[model samples]
Target: MEGTEKPVSALGIEKDLNDWLSVTKSRNGTWWHSAFHNVSAMVGAGILGLPYALSELGWGPGVTLMVLSWVVTLYTMWQMIEMHEMVPGKRLDRYHELGQAAFGEKLGLWIVVPLQMMVQAATDIAFMITGGKCLKKFHDTVCPNCKDIKTTYFIMVYASVQFVLSHLPSFNSIIAVSIAASVMSLSYSAIAWMTCIHKGVIPDVDYSPRSTTTAGMVFSFFSAVGDVSFAFAGHNVILEIQASIPSTPGKPSKKPMWKGAFFSYIVVFLCYFPVAIFGYWAFGNKVEDNVLLSLEKPRWLVAAANMFVVIHVVGSYQVFAIPFFDMVESFLVKKIHFRPTKSLRFITRNLYVAFTMFIGMTFPFFGAIIGFFGGFFFAPTSFFLPCIIWLVVYKPRRFSLSWFTNWFCIIFGVILMTLGPVGGLRQIIVQAKQYKFYS
Candidate 1:
């Protein structure tokens, strides 16, 4: 027992370790591009819901939750990186890999797998809902004289486009797409903020007093928390995006990740704030679920903004779906005994895409879907699992600051999980009754 441990050299050099962990497998881009990619993942079409979130909680609670979400996500990045850096022998480069490494294979397989799949899939569906609605609106605006088109048809078309594009084999392939999506996301965000800022700055029209006692403030407060939580989510894809940063001297450079994390948050706040604050200021409780819908005539700009939404969400959906595809492909390979052949990859991935799209078609109520996924999936993916995993993997001193932070996150997530979905389901049911399938 005295001489059993291996030497440092025997542990393999940093290069060998990086290769084993697959962290450097596709280090195809610089950190800035990687930053944009991850930033894209975080600031999804869910940003559209911020106005509504603000409308529900009023100024103080709404802004507080949003800042809290940002802080939670930043903390998540710190702990997750600490776990990745702390582990010995090999590193955890993927979400499930981290789960299995920290917990056990069964927990990773049963828990992380399904949770990641649900969050990503539900997020993808959200993109479809938003994308379809945007495309239909754009169509209606541009071709008002033309015959009406069903939103479902636009959703199907959007799905088909994604089906073709999602077949690219690796994250490296989508770097350009992610970059483009990130840019468009920023573009539309700017346009949205400018539109709102202009309205709010105007002397005549103002939309203060967005929230009141219509519903219980407590319930509305948590509901907005869920929405912002969803808006800030990136935990599932964080590792994958982090892994894409170019490794220098054959070790994945944490410097780039650290820098990117800081920059990415800046980008998040820049995009999220004006839209939330100004949009609420401009339209108050009269705001639409999608802030864009609240914008007045200037048919061209509304259509322009939504056109970007269509493009951004199309790319964003594919980005999120990659993780889901990995989960499904792994299950098919190990659980179902499917060989990793080109044909099987084609069949499984496309079929999964079709299945998610079908779900999107069935429920076109964007807010309800976002709420449910945010509460059910985002809360855990962003907070609960990371906290639990950190405590298990790092073995932080019990009852200390580390312990308290992790437990706090877990409890926050638990509360959110419990209340977020109940509020969300009520919204979903209301929408379902209001839903007309193809309209």
Candidate 2:
């Protein structure tokens, strides 16, 4: 505390700016913070879409995707840690600033801003849509009168939850939300496990589908890696965690932050892997949008899972919304010299919620939205941007493609970025065609 930075006053623009700076510097998140961030982002959207992904790629490829995603995520996370070392004092909010600092304004705007905004916004949309679906499910089951409710109604409900949660006055409250979400996640995992055992379904090791071609096998492999990436996509929160923790460089506070991230990720994998394997084994061809849906759990457990899914989904949107708000506030304050009054903040936040909800209502199919965004947007955000940023900023010496691991990650990331979007777009087009016919 003696050497740590002092808090800034909440007065003039200078003070506000200084406050932001101080907050970022002193921001240090706990294990709960990191775990919640990761789970909130990855679990909600990915779980809903995993069974569909399995249906297309089969069990072999589906499991492969989860494994590969973990590997890429681990490597990217390591790169982020390295990036932190290179620029010790900067937060992710300063990515464009750092870009401008290292390169120039033109490059930062043309490359960094657009890429960051696109990926972030796309991911935000995915979470919003998933949240909406969860709400619709919750309402149908809990409020029988709401059985025939429109997607817009569900979207409104989801957005309302997000708006309130996002405006929580303290970090402790956010952690509380995270703790609740983790319990929910674990409960759902338990329900899934119980359902599988109750049905007398044995775990199958020969889960991989026989490939028709070399290309098919390759695609299946990439799909598996993408699944892993989905679970690991919350590395964006690393900066937030770093800021939330008490920074004493070589202190215990720092140890927990790092150790917690590692441990929490392991827990995440444990929860996710079994769900993937068992869900595939249980349902095989009939696996629904969510593998949880494939489970013949008790009605109460199903209801609880649905409720938790909604909470998890909304919580994720709140986390992603912060960076968007930060960007908007920074632009207005710096460019127009306009301070965010309470009214303006409320309007801006609601407007964002509205836009996300509108998109969700327009496309209510949970599986389609997740696949499209996961492949088209989340892939770039999780894999491409960080890699590109690192390659540009650090320009690591001795680039060796000959090394197996190096070549594997580079090739894998490139493939995911390239094909993930293509597959996603194709799915979207097919859904659009189907919707046109149905409507």
Candidate 3:
């Protein structure tokens, strides 16, 4: 806000840029359905690791950080929507287009596209990893003596399922999948929460520092920051989710977008806190990266929850990935002169899913992958970009509260990017030593 740029409208680039945004095309849907879609996208594999994440800092610091992430993400969601609203005659469908509109083509092309792709790619990989590992766990419980199902094989199998379902032509066609994914998410969350309660709080759990020395303590703190930040890294999907809400013909309806998103955030918050807290309380510091994995007996319920997770991730991956697929498809058509056809969409999306699954096979440790993406990639996509767009577009006065908050977002994002990646990389390195490819 302290330093604003010349408005894009004045440069007459508005009409030219509308080409990209129009691809997302405004669609009509009920607020609740849109809310369900948002919730579905937000509550994927992230929640599975949330307990371990929260347990890192104990309840107080953990809950505090979770709330802070929610607030900041919420504000940024509004900021992105505001930018879309300002472009009076356009449908700024996705994040990169928003960047292109607000900042310039270079950021949209070089920075936003790649960074956002990295985040989504990481997310899909995490999904594949989660699905594979969950299946492997199920296999182990049902038959201990049988040959272990490899994570890579399970991931490939799940990827095949996605390849079939991914044929749905557009975001509008995926509505049913979204609702199903949301319901499954809620089911597993409730099961996990109840399971934690039944298991009861672990006894004599140490809430003190995991590290003795100051340096070690700082490392632990930074690692915890990365882990916790991973729980709330769904910011990239918001603009697309917001764009899907039905608009009135003459005037876009902000009501549906706000109402839907707010309701969904409520759902997200309610589920996130209890699962994180109670799961930690139940398992203590011994919790696995996936809290569901922490459960020993009651094998049936855990299996059921894992089953739900697998199904949900399949759907969730598509929602998170379709935008990236759209981006790639657009680039191919524009730059490479490929025809935009239904067959091309089918090939591109399936290919993208296959590539992510391959990455998952290589990096099977889900927790570390989550931290890496959330730290390095999502920090800016989630926090920094929205603030920049808001500051530049709104031009809040220097030294004013809004300006400070905007700057704070930028600074906080930078700190998270720097410290978070360090923490995340540390996790990846630590986990890598124990990792077995396709195990």
Best prediction by lDDT: 3
What are the lDDT figures for the candidates, one per model? 0.75, 0.59, 0.76
Residues 351-399 of candidate 1 have per-residue lDDT tens digits of 8779868877877776565666678788898877888888887788989
* lDDT score, candidate 2, position 240: 46
Q: Which regions in candidate 1 have their CA more than 4 angstroms from the true location?
A: 1-25, 201-218, 246-250
Q: Which candidate would rank higher by TM-score, 1 or 3?
A: 3
* Model 1 Cα RMSD, 1 decimal: 4.3
Candidates arranged by lDDT, highest first: 3, 1, 2
Tell me the TM-score of each prediction against the true structure.
0.88, 0.81, 0.90
- Global fold similarity of model 1 (TM-score): 0.88
Which TM-score value belongs to model 2?
0.81
Candidate 3 per-residue C-alpha lDDT over 9-74 given as tens digits, one digit per residue, 9 for 90 to 100: 744543333223323533666678668778877888888778877766667877887888888877
lDDT string for model 2 (361-416, tens) is 67656345444445554565566566666666756565554244444666676777
